[model samples]
Target: MSLSFERTQSVGIIGGGPGGYEAALAAAQLGAEVTLVERAGVGGSAVITDVVPSKSLIATADSAVAISEASDLGVQLFATSDVGRPLAPQIAINLAAVNRRLLSLAGQQSDDLRGQLVDAGVRIISGHGRLDGERAIVASTGPGGTDFDRIEADTIVVAVGASPRELPTARPDGERILTWTQLYDMKALPDHLIVVGSGVTGAEFASAYMNLGAQVTLISSRERVLPGEDRDAAAVIEKVFTRGGMTVLSTSRADSVVRDGDGVLVTLSDGRTVSGSHCLLAVGSIPNTKDLGLEDAGVQLTDSGHIQVNRVARTSVPNIYAAGDCTTFVPLASVASMQGRTAVFHALGDTVIPLEQRRIAANIFTAPEIATVGHSEQDLEDGTVRGFVHKLPLSANARAKMMGVRDGFVKIIASEGSGTVIGGVIVAPKASELIYPIAIAVERRLTVDQLSRVFAVFPSLTASITDVARAMHIVGSDDES
Candidate 1:
């Protein structure tokens, strides 16, 4: 059997991130004449700087920690300390090599995507794309340089991802006070890093640098780190980060950051100053919707400047769609990819399934990665649902002991009487991977009994799920939350 698609429709995607690129491929595969326009390199900020680089750095850092754990398994390992070495030579990760590899992988990915698009007859344009008017997009090489060319599209996918937002008082100079995007340009490691804003991005860097042998201080404006995450999961990560030698400044907001001679000083809102070799501002991200002529094109934007879109990625304007971080969606690469695919499906008059927030899973790559799916403890406070939460400690599991693990747990929430799994949290090594089973249960509306019946290896880390399901039964029997 074979599938056929109409090749007459033209689709123009305006970003090269996961959302934009994926949509381009999908649209092209569906037989649309696709044109992908990107100002920067393909992969956008997410792959070029934010997600890929950070995760790769974390991978190397985690390998270092894993090497240290060899002795725990009764195997001896030794390496001369790089400390006390002169800082004059500036020994650290080579940015040229790192960027070469990062760009290489990104390029390979982009090339593969481009090949797929081209094979399906999609055009690749290297430029910034914006609305000339409805049904038209004007492209130029850069901000000002323009051999202006206008392309008319039957359908348009807006995937202009996002950028690091700067504070009015403490704008980044891209040197001392740096945005997360600027970290990839460095060849030398900071002696001490003061990371303001203890959100997922901030906490990940704070933990990463600490592992990379830098004194890291995390400044959180909220009472706890990862204010947007599940409270118990955030608390576990906070404990892990603190125990790993990172100083956490809770309830402290950075008022300003300034270079003081050789080091940078971060002044807090409480009139205190913290000094560090460098400062990373991980406050949040702002959507790149400003220059796209969104207002002129009649695309509705939120107060924070994110484009408003429906589940299928449809914008207020018909025939126009938005996806990825630019839309008012909780930004995740997975969500971005799904949104991209969904937008293309909707644009082509295909059978489009509206996005279900409950089916999505998110992860925070801390020491012990935190993964969550469906309803969180924070959701309960808003009276959105009636459910009960059941938490299981990793310490109680035999596999954790064998792996020399501590300081993590799995929490599951289900409907009060129905016992249908609605949400879950995992804070352990490979928690990101382990959370999927629970997520599948949640998405499929499976019960605790069904989950408990699923076979998990004895003395294995994944057995923790079965234990958690069993615990839920007890919790249900006791009629306790």
Candidate 2:
């Protein structure tokens, strides 16, 4: 059954993250009366604290790296003294200014998104919102939770995002021991920063601070950094991190983080200790699903506290839906937005497709970014899937040579029998941008021959993608012969 676009329905969205706001906007577009309730800023953590702020910091670090490499490109960056020795160029970072700019950008983005929602006729409520019953949403205005406004909606979208998880032994004081959000508020850079956790967040922060001229020590509890990511990509990043003067401590776990006078000390699980000026705990995140009265509303939650939802974002309750970091195992802003839109569409009785995690492209925002889509090499090794794989090193590409990029490569995986592009991984500078084509191919189920035939710019990073596709095609053809 298809719902009419002109049909008027009410949607109450809790939280203003990518998932919540996007759902509100999508529902409004479908001619639904939308109400968005948020306790903090409109953009959620993705804008205010997590994704935007971190990327902004990474941009600054990237600029510093570019400037450092300018001399190698014959760009006269510094002047030589009379004795033929180059004068020392002073390079310094004003943490206060950098943080101020980051906050400003985040605020601007939030304000812009808020403006868009308002213009689209979605009502914005500033408070903590939750399910009062099965179909009613109650928003408490103050910290006391006294004053409240009740809204009756045909549908409810729970998009309250997650917060950084802290260990009992190493709580974030938001000062010397910090979470990802608190790092932006730092007034001064740490002289020696120890980042605990080797996931995407940890690796990115470690890379950024190292490029920003800090002595960084990265602790990985697993065998390697980004253990969940492509092994080749992780190896490249580890190599880069080590070469950049970062101490990559693999197979190490922080037992506790304690403040020691003017510095911090991180005690490993093995009883050994590493001292640093500051320690960042990027272990993981816990979904913000408690105190929402979800159980009372008949919404089921997973053991990990995430609201249990189907592909279309429907919770166990017929009218309640959940999206974003709170519900998704893959906590990405883009995925959150898609889930939100899907939920709104499904709730309104519109035709919609369930989200396919396999087609989702994820990128790690490090200096040399790692992007992957669809089937992973692990899937093949584990015999979970059968596919043909082809890899091309970026070092062999002309553009890479020009840019002095010798690290990273592109790997493509195609279905064995049909030769359809099933998955790919890219590790390089701007790998994020390069992964989209592979994602498109995977989503559309395009054949390797079709992907290989598409023209890419000569002497470009993207040429390597086409090269990989062509190589896969050739290998497939050889097997047929």
Candidate 3:
């Protein structure tokens, strides 16, 4: 007997970003008829512009940093001078070539996603799509901009991604002032770049550009960069930024940005001015929920226009689900993909696991990246869980010392009563990859003792996780002492 109903279930998804793309695939895999309407290409802004291109650019920047530090690793770069004198080779980013490469990389990723979706039997429609009541989607197709494709389905998924929030006083010219999406269009790195907003996006770009051999000044309205992240991790980033010659303007809020002759001038709220060749507004994002007929169809949205979604990505209307940055959940791409699958699974009456914030892992893609999972120090400070924290500096790790790494630490939180791993933070190079086992421990509610029993490779960064777990286990047990 088949689990699918007598009539094949239909899933109609708007926006072909990670969320919508995954929804279409998941629904089709469940033997449902799937139609995906995307204004942009498949893989959405994340592939076409945001995550892919940005990370590729960061990779280029990382290469530059590696070359600069290669001498410390006994890899010398020398150049002969005209007078038979030795000269240190200068590292320069071929920014136009870098931009082209990243864009091509992004395009290839988008094409791959489209190909996979096609193979999965998902009907892909290229147009702007909106919900027609609760059960149908109307898309404007064709070059004339008036042709419409009316599609009806049993289930509707909204994954329309958000756009960078723009302030009225500081409009993006795409030349002097730019959004994260507009950064790729830059033919050459700016002589000086002023980054407003101290969040993950701003900090990542600031770090990347500074490492790529551009002067960067980061203006943070908050006391520290990457607010709402792990405090210690943010401190490390700020220290790194300062030590790397990036000017940090903490507690300074940008009021407006305007083109000043050949440069852009940023006026702070305190009447101070800072001029740079370009400016980046990484303030925040607004969900693309307007004029989509969401409210008219009774799908509830928050005051800020983010779709109100349940644990399983369900909306006010049972048949309608929402996912991605457009939804009022964690705005990570990984989270969006999970939400998409979860939404489809719930709709199809399949085995569904509701998303929990505690189990979700988040990473900031800065140099010495910050990755975290489960209950944080802030969460445990006054929360219901009786947990104590253990911190291990990466400097003490043999692998880190061998690699000449000295700037990050691994912090773990475990319940005092059960010694269960509740949370962890890793501040190191590629901490994003290092945080997975800890994420699993948090998801499985594994005790520190159990976590310690897991073998980690010697002379590896991951050994620090097990080391911290061992330390926590000893701290939680009096009998061992």
Candidate 4:
């Protein structure tokens, strides 16, 4: 008997975002006939707009902050006057140049990604795509939008990402009032920036602009900022925001936003008014799953229009899968890529490992970044998980003292009796880089003692992780968080 097939397995992916890009590559490498339909050029919004450009802007902001921090270490920066006398240096950000550079970088990345897909033998379609029942995808191709191309496949993956949520009362004009995507068009920084909402997006922009020398007013409907994050972490960020000269109007709401002369005016729910040169609406995002023929294909979606998926990214329809912000998952780019690969693997009879929330790392890119992995302290309060927490402020770390750091901390969460590293949080500069080891421990189910045995470089920020793990180590099963 001989094992053979008449045709190779086929996969069709919608969108060219992180999820779709990874899925297309994986499927092609697996010797499956792959076709990827993308409306945008390539690399999607994550590389083209949201993550790449936003983080590049943040990097510029961090450089500006470093100038001030240098003074604390007795490093003075001075400018020479025309007569040769020393003068106080002025800090300026050429926002137009920054925007141009970041945008160019994003475009280059998108081009590189397209090249990779072509090299991997994945057919790339440049157009809008939607589900054609369960086994095929129909794309509107070419400049005139009249040409249609249909791809029939053994499996289909949907990775169309989401867009910023827009409220009718606070409509974005793309000039004064803008969404996050429109931010790169500004030639100069706003005289005053009013950020509405206190979620992760709002806080990040608020911090960035304030650090960039703009007057920022943050309006939050909750009593405190970053409502669902760790309380201590939120407090630290709030303190930093205030000290950086940001005005946080908590427990307030923006009822309406309208053009006020050359600026903008926001009417509050409490009968107050806040005015600024520009306003940003960072409330949330809605999935881009609309009009994708999901319902017609029997693919289930949440009431909010997000596609529902299982751990392996399988949709309600047997042969269809969804990933990225369009799926009802964590909505991070890394998670989306993982989900995409898992979907293809499970469909092609490859070894598949399901996704787990406890092993996913989340980060907020504020001035002092907040990063976390696995279970949080809030999980214990909800009665869904039992754990203890241990906290060690960054101020106590030797490297922090040498670097003139004053804010942030490292917190550890462990199984109550087993001392397994269940979760951890770090608040500091580049906390994203520091939180990875903890994520590994959570994924590998490493105990506190096991992690403490691993050596970290001396007098480094990561040494603090080892130190905290040592502090939280259980002796005879009676202690540690």
TM-score, cand. 1 vs. native = 0.92
Off by over 4 Å in 1: 1-7, 79-104, 142-144, 474-481
lDDT of 3 at 321: 98
TM-score of each: 0.92, 0.96, 0.97, 0.97
Compared with the true structure, the alpha-carbon lDDT of candidate 4 equals 0.92
Q: Write the per-residue lDDT of candidate 2 for residues 1-481, one digit (tens) a residue.
A: 2247555789999999999989998998888889999998898999999898899999999888888877777775666899999876856888889999999999999999999999999999999998998899999997687889999998999999999998999988888999998998788888999999999999999999999999999999999999999898899999999999999999998999999998899999999999999999999999999899999988888889998889999999989999999994468999999999999999987879999889999999898999999999888899988988999999999999899786899999988888888899999998899999999999998888888889999989999999988877744443321
Better of 1 and 2 by lDDT: 2
Please list the Cα RMSD from the true structure of every candidate, rounded to 1 decimal place.
Answer: 4.3, 2.4, 2.0, 2.3
Cα error, residue 340 of model 3, in Å, equals: 0.2
Name the best candidate (by lDDT). 3
Q: Can you tell me which runs of candidate 4 are displaced by over 4 Å?
A: 1-6, 477-481
Of 2 and 4, the candidate ranking higher by TM-score: 4
Query: Can you give the lDDT of residue 202 in candidate 3?
Result: 96
Error of 4 at 364 (Å): 0.5
Candidate 4 residues 1-481, lDDT tens each?
1112477989999999999999998898788989999998788999998988998898889999999779899999998989999998889988899899999999999999999999999999999999999999999988877899999989999999999999989999999999999999999999999999999999999999998889999999999999978898999999999999999999999999999999999999999999999999999999999999999999999999999999999999999999999999999999999998899888887889999988999999998999999999999888778878888899999999999989999998988888899999999999999999899989988888778888898799888888888998788753333
Relative to the unseen true structure, what is the C-alpha lDDT of residue 450 in candidate 1, on a scale of 0 to 100? 81
lDDT of 2 at 258: 95
